[model samples]
Structure formats: structure tokens, C-alpha cells
Target chain A: MNPLAEIVAITAVCVLSGCLGSLLGLGGGTFVVPILTLAFGLDMRLAIGASVISVVAGSAAASPRYLDEGFANLRVAVALEVATVSGAIAGALLAGHLSTRALYTVFGVVLAVSAVQMLRHRQDRDGLAVPDDPIADALSLHGTGTGTTVRDIRPYRVTRTATGLTMMTAAGAISGLLGIGSGAMKVPAMDLAMRLPIKVSTATSNLMIGVTGAASAVVYLQRGDVVPLLAGAVALGTVVGARIGSRLLAVVPAGALRVIFLVVLLIVSVQMLLRGLA
Target chain B: MKAAPGAPEAGARQVALVLRIGGGLGAALVLAGLAVSFAESGGGWLHGSGVDPLGGDATMRLSDLIGGLRHGRAGAIVLLGAIVLAATPAAGVVTAGYTWLRARRAWLAGVAVVVLLLLVLAATLGATE
Candidate 1:
């Protein structure tokens, strides 16, 4: 692909990815990474660097609405960052020693797992039950459970706090290692492990991803994996796409979209795994 | 119980505000760089070898990038834009930390500071390499 054509192509695909990712409450990095490595023929390392830029771009763009609308929990976000940020740095350091093929293999596994999780789509109406965790109480992590879009805000007690942190650490490491936003891991850690409401977990994951991506982004930048023109185009496309996607989410019936996205992810995951093997 | 406006929610709003301004500025600069690049290169964007994202030859020091901008190099400007975009979230994190402080949440403030330090450390590490 012509270098400029590559930028233009990635930008176009990223716009669609950003739009759909935001609409589904999945950060855009998943789509961004595959497109760069597969379509643009960028090395896995360079692709990760560019993908993180788009993830941060989309987060910065859509976060205002998610936060202001009461979908995200700030206390939880801050609490989790201590684990995620540290893990991201660790993952980044490890990336230096790991070979290109090793990174690709890991990326394939992550994509496959994320695809299955997305298809599952946790039941929405599970009653909120707040657990008795002293750490959560000390940190004031127990949220008031006032929702903006989901209207039925139930303040739930946290459970398995330590496990949640452990999962978050892994998520952060995967994020830094793969150059993804790590929402796939973070969301489950918060939603299933910690028992946060799905809405809060998803939105908070969006907020956390930007910070996680930014942290490891410095590592990529230092290593010169970030191509400015390519990254800039991806960033531009993502921000624009996220803006449009967020607006559409209000009206769209997400059930159908979720099904469509599941099939797409499965195919992409398989392709990535094969590429890694090859 | 009907929910009242909370301090954390308010702090999040402020952080969101910072992100909007910082990200918008960064995106605008990048787009501007693209326009300039198109004009200077005269439709050669598609003809050059694919982007060398991890190549040493493509990497330049921050100082050199600034100097390149003076010479009207679009790539330099684009790089500046990227650097700004990368930092914008850290700025927001600091802002959030400050907000947590004002709200008298010391632990959250501490968390913010720690994350801020990590970001600085990461960037410093990048510069060294």
C-alpha cells in the first residue's frame, strides 16, 4: 500500500471502528489494531502504537457524555488506576524483551476471548447487591448508584475486591503488551468480579482505557514505534467516529448490533490467530 | 432515596471539560498538519513506502521536531500534535487529582498523584531511549 494510501485507508476503517466501538460501549482499539496490522501491513508493534492513539482519542472525545450522564463511576476509576497503571508500565517493560511473534500470539488469544465474552452479553436486569468489603468502604468506593441512561440506579456493595484488582493488573498488562485499550479485560473485572452495575463498569472501562493507553504510549513513543502521520490520522478518524457513534447509540437497538459485532469479532479473531501462527 | 449531586460526579465533569479542550486542540493541529502535508507533498501520500512506525530513522528528538516545524515540515507538526494528544489524558488525570483534593478526598488525590508520577516516569523513559 502507498504510505499515504495506508494512512487514508486506516483512517477510513478506524472511523467506522470508532463509531461502532463507541456505540457498543467497546473502546475502538480492538478494531484499530486488526485494521492496521492486517490491512495496512504495519508491524504488530507499530500497529499497537497507532491503535493506542485512536483509543485515547476516542475516550477523550466520548468521555464527557459518559461521565456527565452518570454512566461512569469516578471513585471506582481512581481506585482501579493504582493497579492498572502500574501493570501497564510492567507490561510495557516486558514488551521490549518479547519477540514480535510472541506478541502476536498473545494478541490472538486476547481477541478470541474477547469475542466470546462479547457474545455472552451479561444479563442486564440482575439485581444489585452491595457486599460488605471494608476496603471499598474505606475508599468510599460504594457508589450512590444514580444512573443517567439506565434510570434504575441501584447502589451495590463490592465483592472480591482483591480479585478485582488482580484482574485489573492483568488487563493493564495486556493493554500495554498488545497496544490495546484493555477494556475487554477491565469491564469483566469490574462488572462480574466486583459486581458493579454493567453500565458503570462499561463506562468506567472507557475512562480507564485512555489513561492505560497513555501510560504505555510513552514506551512506544520512546521506542519510536509511533508514526506521527499514521497515528494522527487514526486519532482524527476515531474522535470523529466516536462523536457520531455516541449520538447513534441513543436511538439504535443494541441487541441486533451486538449479534452482528459478535460474528465479526469471531472472524477477526480467527484471522489474527492464523496470522500469528503463520 | 433520590440522589443529590455528588462531589465525585462534579469532579468527573471538570475532568471531562479538560479532555474536551485538550483533545480538540490536539486533533485540530493534526488535521492542520495533514492539510499542510498534502500541499507540500503534492499528492505523493500514496506513493511513498508504507509508514515506518517503529523504525529508528523515523524517530526524531523533540527539539529536532520543533526545529523542523520552523522549516515548514508537516511531519514535525503532526508529531507535535501526537505528543499533545498523548499527554492530554495525563493533564486530565492531574486535573482530576486536584479536584479530588479540593473535595477533600485525600486517598483519591494520592492515587491521582501516583498515576501522574508514573506518566512522567514513562515519558522520561521514552525520552532516554
Candidate 2:
């Protein structure tokens, strides 16, 4: 492809994927990697390296703003990082030696499962109403109402610490292995297993994915899995795409956004499977 | 927690808008630079046998892609640097945009940025080989 054409293509993909991901609460990596590898014919390792860079860039960019708005719980995020970072390191090391076929198969399966889960629970938007454990009270993982009187002062507590941590470990491992941000898995786990509010779960997961990506990125760098030129390109595209998507968030309806997300996931899963088989 | 009644909504909107435009432009510049350089290099030079900074085959090693930019055509090096600088902020712009559009979930935006970066890296690096 011509330089201009390639640039436009990548930019379009990134922007669309970012929008869908944000709407559905998924990491763009799940969609981005498959397109690059299957549609664009790039190698899996190279795609993974680029994806990792983009994940860090996106996380860092969005984090401060969220923190400033009190949407992100720094205390909870920092506490979780201890587990995520370590898991990422192990996952990255494993990624270096894993067969591309295996990686794709696993990634495809995960995407399919995640898609089903999203579809099944599409109507459940209510946040946790009651604290299920002492840790949640101590941590103050509660939600305060901004305008509404009926749902004012909703407190979100971590009911299942052990389960949440275990899920995080799995999320971190997937992140390192496939070079995906894995927020899809992490957010849901936190929400369902630990009973965190959707907003808090999303913010906390975002805070932690960067740390996880950083840990694995180092491993990829050492293993010679990361390509600077390619990484640079992906990082650039993701940043631009993410910026566009973030801006459009308010104008889009929640239902429409969710549909877009499901479509993207379906397409990505097929692409990953095809790439792995090829 | 409820915001104190009478918080500055206008100010917050202004800040968000500013962040969006600034971050978008930065990311675009980086992608443009990488696309230009990768095209100019014809994607063949990345695979040509050459000694990289790591003292290994430049084609197979990721380090070579990073460490070997200086050794490439001078124009390519400049483009590479521009791409890296621009791409970082682009990530922020993309994330913010996503947050505005969908769940307003900050992490999803972060994930978007990271994934885009990885795609760029893979394309540019893999093309070299």
C-alpha cells in the first residue's frame, strides 16, 4: 500500500476500534492485533509488540484526567498493581516461547467467550447496592451520586478479594501472552467477582493495565520481540485513534455503542482464528 | 461522591476539549512520520543483513529496529523520531475521545491507545524484515 493509504487505513481502523472498545468496555488490542496480523499480513510477534506500546500510551493518557475527576480510585488501583505487574512479567516471558498458533487459538477462544458474556448480560447496569465484605468498607469503594436523589451515595465494596485477585492474575497473564490490554476480562471480573461498580472497575482496570503492559513490554524488549519502528507506528496510531474516540463518547448512545463493540469483537475473533490457522 | 453544588461544568468541558485537540494532533503527526518513513525505506531495508547496535542480525531482532534507526538513511531516522514523539500523545487523544463517546470508561481509552501503539510497532518493525 502507498504510504498515505496505509496511514489512512491504520488511522481509520484505530479510531473505529477505539470507539467500539470504549463503548463496550473492551481493550482495543483484541481488535487491533487481529486486523494487523490477518488483514495486513503482519507477523504476530510484531503485532504484539506494537499493541503493548499502544496500551501504555492509551492508559497514561486517560489516567490523569480520570484521576482528577475522582472517577479513578488511586488507592485501589495501586494496591492491585502489585499483583498485575508480577503476572505481566511472567506472561511476557511465556509469550516469547509460545507458538503463534497456540497464542491465536487461546486469544480467539477468549474473545468468543467474552463476546458471549457481554451479550448475555446486556441489561444489567445496576451497580452493587450493598457492601459484601469488610475490605470494601475499609477501602471505601463506594459510589456517590452527582445529581440524582434516588440513587445517591451508592457505596461499592469488594466482596471477593481472593476471587478478584485470581481473575486479575489471569487478565495479566493474557495481557502479557497476547499483548492485549485485557481490560475486557479484568473489568468484568472486578465487577462480577468483587462486586465493584462498573465505573470503578473500569478505572481501576485501566490504571493497572499500563503497569501490566510495561512489565511485559520489558520482557518483549529483552526477547527481541518488540520492533521499534513498528511499535512506534502502532503507538502513534492508537494515540490518535483513542483521542478521537474519547471525544465522541458523549455524543454516542449507549445501545448503539454496544452493538458496534460486539461487531468488532466478532470480526476480531474470526481474524485471529484465521491468522492462527494460516 | 456528589460534587459540591455549583461545580464548574464549563471549565471541565473546556479542559476536556483542549486535551482532545492537543492529543489528536500529536498522535497524527507520529503516525504520519512512521507511514512516510516506512514507505520511503520500501520495507526491504529492515530485512537486509546488517549489524545493529545490539551486534545481532538487524532483521530478526527487535532491538535492531530501535537501535538501528541511526544507521538507516538520514531521512528515515528523522521520520522515526517524529513518529515516536507524536505517537505518545496521540494515545492520550484517542483515549479521551473514546471516553467521551462510550462508557466514559477511562481504562477502555487507555486500552485503545496501547493497542494502537502496538499495531504501529508491529507494522513498522515487521516491514523491516
Candidate 3:
């Protein structure tokens, strides 16, 4: 392929993926890897490498905007990081010992379960009365959503802290073992388990995904999986797309976001199941 | 229990500042590297010359980046940009930790430290792989 064409093509794909990634808190790898491999005919390793860079780029670029908008919960992010990072470390340690196919199968089932749960609670809004967990109380994870265009202010409380943390651990472990960001897992955990606002869940997941990606990106870099020109094109494109997506989040209704997330979740679940079976 | 007035806002601002700086620098470097590659290829880089003009060598270590920079390798410059981009979130985490400490939230600050340590561990594990 012509160097220029390659750069242009990859950038275009990244722009679309980055937009969706930031909008949905997915980090874009779920889309980028498959598109590069199946559509563009790129090497899988190369695609994963580029996906990692793109995920970091999209997450990092959009995060500041989310923070400014008060959609991202920093307290929740920090509290959950303890669980996700520990899961990631454990998964990394057990990476070689476990079977990828089996992990995929299990993760697919988990996603399916999460999708069902999300659907069942689609109408549930934040600021609802719920029993509080001791950990959430201690960490002060509850907050009032400010700086959002959707409402003047919506105060929300955290619940089922232990469940959310457990889900985060599993999410992190999946990412560590599969070398994916697994934002799909993070958003659902926050929204369904911790009972955070959907926007807050998405935005905070956006921020957290970048932090998790930073760790494995080094491995990809050292292993020579990252092609500089290719990954650079991806990084550049995702940043631009993420900026656009972040602005869109202020207007995109939470109900609509939930629908989009469900579609993405189902698609990802089926894809993982197929891969595992294959 | 409630936090100090505007504590979350203050923390968010600090984290945002770090992210903007890191993300901006990374994007600029990537753009610059692309420009250099275009210049080296004399506009044929994007137009499809028979030879690949922008192929970058895979760098194995940080030291390799310095060496590549001395040679003005476009790929290395881009790789460095990507690495910086990847590192931005971790930097944000560190900044958040500092913010937590300033708020006198020892537990949250300690959580930040543990997160950082885990990140380093994950990186080290990857490096060994």
C-alpha cells in the first residue's frame, strides 16, 4: 500500500472509531481491531498495536473535556482504580497460564449478562434512593452532577460498592489478559452495579480506560507490535475524533446513550462468542 | 460525609491540566513527525512512490528513542509521541493523587499510590514478556 494512502485510510477509520469510543466510553479498540483486520486486511498484531495507541489517544483526549463538564466522577474513578488495577496485575501474571479461548467464552457470557441487566434497568435514573454500601460512604463516592447541559444538577449516591469493585476487577483482568481496554465491562459495572448515572459511568470509564491502557501499551511498544507511522496516524485521528465526541456527550441524552451501549454490547458479546468457538 | 467545597472541581482541574499538556505535546510531535516524513519523501510519501518512505524502525527501549532522535528518524519521533500519549493518563493519575493529598484525604491519596505502583508492576511484567 502507498504510504500516504495507508496513513489516510487508517486515520479515517480511527476518526470514526474514536468518535464512538469517546461517546460510549469504549476506548474504540473493540471496533478498530476488527475493522483493521477484517476490512483493511492488516495483520492482527499490528491492528491490536494500533488499537492500543488509538484507545489511549481517544480516552486521554476526551477525558479533560468530560472532567470540565463534570460528567466524569473522579472520586469514583479513583475508588474503582484499586480494583481494576489489581485485577489487571493478576491477569497479567496469569496471562500465559490461562487459555485465551476459555477466557473469551467466559467474558462473552459476562457481557451477555451485563447487557440483560442494563436493559432491565434502562429506565433507572441516578439520584434515586438506594441503600448505601459502607465503602461508598467512607470513600464519599456520591456526588452531585454539575456542569452538564442535560440538567441543572442531579445529585447521585453510590450503592453496592463491593459488586462494582468485583466487576471492575474482572473487567481489568479481561483487558490485561486479552490486551484490550475492556471499557465495555467498566461502564456496565458502574451504571448497573454502582448505580452511577449513565453519563457519569461512561465519562469516568473513558478516563479510567486510558489509565489501564497505559500499562499494556509499553508491552506492545517493546514487542515491536506498534508500527510508528501507522499508530501515529491512529493517534492523531482519534484525538480529533474524541474532541468532537466529548462535545456531543453534553447533548446526547442518557437514554439514547444507553440504547447505543446496548447495541454495542450485544455485538461485542456475539463477536467474542464466535471467536471463542472458532 | 461531605468533601471540602470545590475539592472535586479543583482535583478535576488539575487532572485536566495534566491531560491537556500530555495530549497536546503528543499530538504536536506526531504531526511534526508526519511532516518530516513528508518532507523526506518530497511529497511522494503520500502519493505512492515505489519505495516505502515512512517506515519506522521498532524501538526496543527508551535509550533507542534518544538514538533515533539524533538521526531524525520520523518513525522514532512518532513512536515517542505515542509513548507520551500512552503515559498521559498515568500522569493524570499521579496528579489526582497529589490533589487528594492536598485535600487531606489520606485514604484516597493512598489509593492513588497503590494504583501507580500497580501500573508500574504491569509495565514491568509486560517488559519481561
Candidate 4:
């Protein structure tokens, strides 16, 4: 591939992925990795490497904005980090050993699962729901998330603390293993299971994904899977795209977009699965 | 149990600051590096250029990648960017960890410490191995 063309291709991929990721409140790595592998024809490991950096870049671009707006729950994110970090390290180490076929299969399965979860997500009822769990009480997870343009400061309680942590552990492992930020898993665990607002879940997931990627990034770097130029293109593209997506969030309805991305992901996953089997 | 009125905001700001700086710097360095590669080497970046991204060379180490940034090679700059990109999250861990520790939140601090250590260990092992 011509270096310029490669850069252009990757940058374009990240931009699209980043924009959609931010708009849907999902991180870019999920989309970026598959696109890098199936469409761009990068090796699975290489794609994973670039995906991690792009994930970090996307998170960096959006975390501050989300945090300032009071969407991410810091305490919840912190507590959950325990599971993700540990799981991520293990997953990172594991990815090094897994065959390319295994990675593709895993990636396909993950994307399919995530797409389904996204489809099933329903906006929680609007109310002042106080958390009844002791852990929530201890951590003070009940609080108000300052709204974006379309919403207001919504007060809510986080429940099923143990479940959230456990699910996050799985999400982290998947992230490290596949090199995709497990925002798909994190959002559902928080929004559906723990019963937090989707906005808060997504924001916190965005922040946590960076840390999760960092955990695996070390392994990828050490293992020499993260190609500098490729990762660079992804990082730059995702950062730029995420910024644009965040701004567009106020007016764009993401529900329909989510359906479209899910379909795209499903098709890509099938191709990826065939590629893996081949 | 509510936190102080401004505490969460302050903490969020601090974390946000770390992310913005790390990400922005990383992006700038990477872009600058690509430009320099083109300028000095004549479309070097547009072809099979930028240091080989594979192999066990010690030069690829994080510390060395940062060290190379002083010489102004585009590849080094990109590597430095990657390092910076990777480090942003670690910085977040430290910021959150230290803050929670000061507040006597042992669990949060402990989680942060463990994560930070793992990252350092990954970098260290990658460097040595």
C-alpha cells in the first residue's frame, strides 16, 4: 500500500468510526478494529493494535466534555476499574497467544453480541430513582448527571453493584483480548443491569475504555503489535472524528443510527468470520 | 453521603486536563512527525517509511521512543505519540488513585494502584523482553 493511501484509508476509517462511536456513545475501537482488518486488509493483530490507540484517542477527545457536563460517574468508573484493569491485562497477554482465526471468531461474536445488546436497550423511566444497594450507599453512586442540550440534570441511583463489577470484568477481558474497547458490554451493564441512565453509562464507559486500552496497550507495544504509523493514523482520525460527533449529539437522533451501525456490524462480522475460517 | 459541593467538579477537571493534554500532545507530535518525514525525506511518509514497527529492537522501547523525539525523526515522533497516547490513561489512574487515597478511600486507591502497577509492568516487561 502506498504510504499516503494507507494513511488516507486509515484516517477515513477512524473518522467514520469515531463519529458514529461518539454519536452512539460507543467508543471507536469496536468499529475501527473490524474495518482495519476486514476492509483495509491489515493483520488481525495489527488491527487490534491500532484499535487500542484509536480507542484511547476517542476517549481523550470526549471524556473531558462528558465529565464537565456531569455524565460520567467517577466513583462508579473508579470502582469498576478494578475488574477491567485486571481482566484487560490478562486478556492482553492472552491475545498474544491466540491464533488469528480465534481472534476473528471472537471479534465477530463480540460485535454480534454488542449489536444485539444495543438493539435491546430501552431508555429507563424518567424519575428520581434512589439506589437501594449498600454498596451504592457506601460509594454514593446516587447523584445527578448534568444534561446535554436535549436533556437536563437527571438524578438517579446505581444498583446491582456486584453485577456491574462482574460484567465489567468480562468487558475488560474482551477489550484486552480483542483490542476493542468493551463499551458495548459496559453500557448495557450500567444502563440495563445497574439501571443508570444511558448517558452516564456511555460517558463513564468512554473514560474507562481509555484505561482499559492503556492496560492492553502496554502488552501490544511490548509485543510489537502496535504499528506506529497505523496506530498514528487511527489515533488522529478517531480524535478528530470524536470531536465532531460530540458536537452533533445535541440534534442527531442516535436510535436509528444505532440500528444502521448494527446492521453494518453484522455484515462485517460475517465477512470477518468467513475470512477467519478461510 | 454527599461529596463536597465542588469536589467532583474539581476532580473531573483534573482528569479531563490530563486527557486533553496527553491526547492533544500525542496528536500534535504524530502529525508533526509525519510532516517532518515528508519534508526531510521527500514523501518518505507517503511510502514504506516510518521506522519498522516490528522487531525486538531496544530502540522501540517507550523510553527510547521518547528519547528519539529530541532528534526530530518523524518515526520517533509517532512512537512518542503512541507512548503519550498510552500514558494518558495511566495518568488518569494516578490522578484518581491519589485523590481517592487522600480522601481515605482505600478501595478506590487500591484499585488504582494495582492498575497503575500493571501498566508499568507491561511497559517494563516489553522493554526488557
Candidate 5:
């Protein structure tokens, strides 16, 4: 492929990936990696590296909009990040030693289970219940979501801080090992376990993914897996795509968002299972 | 309990500002690098066999980056941009933690500090390995 054509193709692909990523509060890497490697015939390591960078770029670009719209819970993000970062470190260290096939199977099963739980807990009313976790209470993890109008403002209390944090560690570890955002894991944990609204879960997940992606990104950088021209094209695409996605998120109804999340979840779950089995 | 009026908004605005700066600069540098590469290559930027310009390892060091910059290597400029982009989230975290501290949200601030430390530890461990 010609240089201009290749760059344009990558940017275009990443634009769609970034849009979906921001909309789903994912890092956009899950889509970017396979597309870059399979379609463009790029190196796997370089694709992962560029995908990681795209994740960071998408997260950073979309988060401000989420924050402005009051969907991203800062307190929640800060609290859970500790576990995610720790898990990422451990996962990075454990990377080469473990069989990725086994890891994929485990992650796939986890995603399937979480998808079921998320479906079972589709009722968003749980957000209004008094949270039982003292840690969450003390940290002020509860917040009001400003979805569309004054009527759309829903105040929510966070529950099961321990469970959520535990899941976050797993999410981060997966992120480190796979060089993906692990938002599929995170959204379920937050929505089902922590009882956050789906929008809140998605937005908060967006806020934390950049930090999580960064944990492993530096290693990729030092390893020289990151090719500048490709990564640059990807980063540019994500910035634009994430901007468009964030704007859309502000108006998308919570029910629609939940449905979108679940569909994406099942697709990712199936993909993971297929990879593991293959 | 309701948050102080505009406190969250204020902090959010500040963090958003930082994000905009970082993302904007990173994107700009990337664009500039691509343009420079195209110009330098005289529009046949994809030429040459046995070397994938968009793939392979380009292990960069501080001094190497400096030298590359002096010689107008587009790869160096783009790499620098990517590094800056990678660092942006950490900077955003610091800003968030600082804002929390300023608001006297001690627990939130503490959590932020721990998260930051863990990130640094991950990088350090990754480097060692």
C-alpha cells in the first residue's frame, strides 16, 4: 500500500473504532488490534502498541465531555484506579510466563458471566438504594447523573466497593496482558456489582482506562514496539472519533446505552471465547 | 449530601482543560510529523523494500531522539508526540488529585496518590523486566 493510502486507511478504521470505544467507555483497542493486524498485515506487537496509544488518546479525548456532562464519577474513578493499576503491574510482570490461551478462556468465561449478571440487573432502580458499603460512603462515591434534562437527573449510591475493586484488579490485569482497555470487564463490574447507572459506569470507565492503558503503554514504548507514523495516524483518528462519540453519549438515553453495552458485551464475549478455543 | 456549588464542575473544567492541551498538542505534533515525512520523501514515502516504516522496532533513547531531531527525522518527532500523549493521563491524574486536595477531599486525594504511585511502580517494574 502507498504511504498516504495506508495512513488514511488506518485513520479511517480507527475513527470507527474510537467512536465505538468512547460510546461504550472502552479504550478502542479491542477493535483496533485485530483490524490493524488482520486487515493491514501489521506486526502484532506493533499493533498492540499502537492500539494501546489509541486507547489512551480516546480516553483522554472523551473523558472531558463525560466529566462536563456529570456522567463520570471522579470519586469512583479515583477509588477503583488503585486496584486496576496494581493489577496491571502484576499482569505486566506475569505476561510472558503465562499461557495466553488459558487466560483468554478464563476472561471469556468471566465476560459471559458478567453479561448474564448485567442482563439480570437491568433494572437501574438499584442506583437509588442506600449503599451498604461504608468505604463507599466515606469516599462519597454516590453521585447524581445529568443525563438529558432536569428530570433525567438520577442520584445513585455506590455499593459493594470491595467487589467492584476486586473486579477492577482483574480488569486492569487483563488490560496489561492483552493491551486492551478491559472496559467490557469494568462496565459489568460497575453496573452490576457497584450498582452505578449504566451511563455512569460507562463514563467512569472511560475516565480510568487511560490511566490503566498508560500502565502498560510505557513498557510497549520502551520495547520499541510503537511505530510513530502508524500510532500517530491512530491517535489522530481516535481524538476525532472520541469527540463525536462523547457528544452522542450526552443525548443517548440510558436504556439505549444499556442495550448497546450488552450487545457489545456479548460480541466481545464471543470473540474472547473464539480466540481462547482457537 | 450535596457537593459545594460548582465544586465538581470547577474541578472537571480544570481537568478538561489539561486534557485538551495534552491531546491537542499530541495530535498537532503527529500531524506535523506526517507532513514533514511526506515532504522529505518527496511524496514517495512508502518506497523501499526490506524495511516496514510503519512496523518494526525503533528503539529510541533520549540522546538518539535529540540527534534525530537535529537531523529532522519525522519518526523522532512522532515518537515524542506519542510519549507526550502517553504521559497525558498521568498528568490528568495529578491534576485531579491536586484539585481534590484543594477541595479538602482527603480520602479522594489519598486514593489518587496511591493510583499514581502504582502507575509509576508498573513502569519501573516493566523497565526492569
Candidate 6:
């Protein structure tokens, strides 16, 4: 494809993915990578490099809004960053040694799993009204209060911090290997295992994912896997797309948004699987 | 509850202009650095020693040192741009958080965040490549 045309196509995919990802509280990179690799026929390593750039862009574009809204708990995010950053470094290092074929197969499976989870967890119900543990209190896992639009911010406690950290480490490893944001796993682990409310988990995950991507991105940079032209294009596209997606949240109905999210996940999952098998 | 109207509007316009100039300059510097390195690497003729404008790398026995500088410069420029890009989202969260803390104009802040995110996404995507 012509360079300009390729950019335009990738930008379209980035915008669509960001819009749905934001709505579903999933990181846009999850969707962006599959599309770039499968649909565009880009190499997995290159796709990963490009995906990291997009993740950084999307996270940066979305972070301010979440922080402004008091939805992001900086203290909680910072604490989690320790785990995420460490995990990211490990994962990134591992990625360099993995075979491309193995990476694609694993990525395809992860995508399918993510799609199922999104489909299964359709309703946005408030979690346990109050956190009931020491870990939650120490980490400030509880929500302050609910918003007018989203309802009351429910406080959640970490039932098993070790478990959550382990999952995060695994997620980080996958992120490095595949170049996906791994937010799909992080948010759920935080929300369900750590017992954080959905919104808090989502925002906090967004904050941490960037650090994870950064750790892994450095590995790619050293390996010369990241093409400057491709990274630049994807990053530029994702930032703009994430901005639009964030804005559209207000007007779009939450239910409809969830459906869109599921559809995108399903499509991307299939695409990845096909690409891997091919 | 309207702003002393014109004053707020003027301030808003000023902020917009600042953001525009900041974003444009940032993108330009990033692109230029990348182009220069691409040139020096013999990656292509448009940016190589044959037509080298940035002489540091393209024409030097100290080519390794110049190459290192180019790589470092490109990395720094890209990192800064990424941070600036990420700030838009952080700003939204901050704005919303502040409004919630203040207990006023919460909806306005929410709407602003959504708008800002979309605008950033559109502009970034549109400008790709």
C-alpha cells in the first residue's frame, strides 16, 4: 500500500478502536495491535512497536481527563506502578527471546479470551459497597463517591494483593511479548481480584499500562524493532483517536457502547487467530 | 452563572492558541530528527550523505559519535512529544477531579474531558504520516 494510504487506514482503525476501548474501559492497544498485524499484514514485532507508541499516546490523552474527574487515584496508581514497572521490564526482556510464531499464537489466544470476558461482563454493576480489608485501606482502594452520571463510587478492598500482583506480572509479561497494553487483564484483576470499583480500576490501569509499555518499548528500541516511521504514524493516530473517543463517552449510551466494544473484540480476536494460523 | 462572558471566551481562545503552537512545534521537531537519522543511515537518498543538510552524521570520521547524538536526540524528542500527548488525558482527569472536589460544574468538566479526548484523537489520527 502507498505510505499515505497505509497511514489513513491505520488511523481509521486506531480511532475506532480507541472509541470502543474507552467506552468498554479496555485499553485501545489491545484492539490496535491485532488489526495492525492481521489486517495490515505488518510483522508482529513491528506491530508491537507501533502498538506501544499508540498506547502511550492513548494513555496520555486519556489520563488528564481521568485525573481531572477525581476518578484516578494517584496514590493507588503509583503504588501499583511498582509492580507494573517491574513486571514490564521482565516481560520486555522475555519478548526479545520469544519466537514470532509463538508470540502470534499466544496473542491470538489472549484476544479470544478477552473477547469472551468482555461479552460475559456486560452489565456495569457497582461492586461491594464498602471495602473490608487492611490491604484496601492501605492502598486506598475505595472510591470517594459516585458521579452524577455513573452512580456512587463504591469502595473495594484487596482480597488478595499477592494474587493481584501475580496476575499483573503475568499480564506485564504478555504485554512485552505482544505489545498489547495488557489493560484487558490488569483492569479485571484490579476490579475483581483486588475488589476495586470498575471506574477506579480502569483509570488506574490506564495510568500504569504506560509504564509497562515504556519498559517493554525500551527493549524494542534496543533491538531496532521499532520503525520510527511506523511508530510515529501509529502514535499520532492513536492520540487523536483516543481524544475523540473520550469526548464521545458523554453522548453515547453505556449499553450501546458495551455492545460495540464486544463486537470490536470479537472481530479482532478472529483476525488475530486467522493471522496466527496463516 | 455565565462568565463575565467575553473575558472567559478570550482566555479560552488564548489557551487554544498556545496548545496549537505547542503541539505543532513539538511534532515538527520530532519529525525532523527522525528524518535526519533516516538520512544518515543511508536509509534513503532524501535524507542521506549525498544531500546531507545536517552534516554531523553524514560527513564525519566521528560518524559513530554523531550517530549516537542523532539517536539520543530523536529518542528525547519522541519521549517529550509522547509525554505532551499523554497529558491531554491526564488533564481531563485532573479537571474532572477538581470539579468533583469543588462540587460545582462537574458535568461541564466531564463534557470538556470527553471533548478534549476526541479532539486530540482526531487531530493525531488526521496528522498521521
What DockQ does each candidate score versus the true complex, computed on alpha carbons? Answer: 0.45, 0.10, 0.41, 0.37, 0.45, 0.07
Model 3 residue A145 CA deviation (Å) reads 1.6
Docking class of 1: acceptable
Q: After superposition, how far is residue A224 of candidate 2 from its true place, in Å?
A: 1.8
Instruction: List per-prediction Cα lDDT, in the order shown.
Output: 0.76, 0.56, 0.76, 0.77, 0.77, 0.57
The window of 10 residues in a row where model 5 chain A has the poorest summed lDDT is A146-155
Chain B TM-score (each prediction, in order): 0.81, 0.34, 0.79, 0.71, 0.79, 0.37
* lDDT tens digits by residue: candidate 4, A1-278: 76577778789878989988876667898888888777767778888887887888888888877776566787788778778877888788888889999999888888888878867758545664545888877766676763433445556678899998899889989999988888889888888888876667777888888888888888787776766767887888999998887666556766778778889878877877887778
For model 3, residues B1-129, the per-residue Cα lDDT tens digits are 211212246599889989999999998888898778767774675567655532434333444678779899887888889889988988999999998899998888888898899888877876676
Better of 2 and 4 by DockQ: 4
Ranking 2 against 5 by lDDT, winner: 5
**Local accuracy of candidate 2 as per-residue lDDT tens digits, B10-41:** 12333334434544453554455455555765
Clashing pairs in 5: none
Residue pairs clashing in model 3 are none
Mark the 10 consecutive residues where model 6 chain A has the least summed lDDT: A139-148
**Candidate 1: where are CA atoms >4 Å away?**
A1-4, A121-128, A144-149, B1-8, B46-64
Q: Per-residue lDDT of A78-116 in model 1, one digit per residue for the tens? A: 778778888888888788778877887788899889877
- TM per candidate comes to 0.90, 0.70, 0.85, 0.88, 0.87, 0.70
True contacts kept of 6: 0.04
TM-score, structure 4 vs. true: 0.88
Candidate 1's displacement at residue A259, Å, is: 1.8
Model 2 residue A137 distance off true place after TM-score fit, in angstroms: 4.4
Model 2 chain A: worst 10 consecutive residues (lDDT sum):
A144-153
Q: Where is model 2 more than 4 Å wrong at Cα?
A: A122-132, A137-154, A274-278, B1-129
Q: Lowest summed-lDDT stretch of 10 residues in model 1 chain A? A: A144-153
Segments in model 5 whose C-alpha atoms lie over 4 Å from true places: A96-121, A124-128, A146-150, A253-278, B1-10, B46-50, B57-64
For candidate 2, chain B by itself scores a TM value of 0.34
- Expressed as tens digits, the lDDT of each residue in A38-94 for candidate 2 is 776767777787677667655544544444444445445544554565566667767
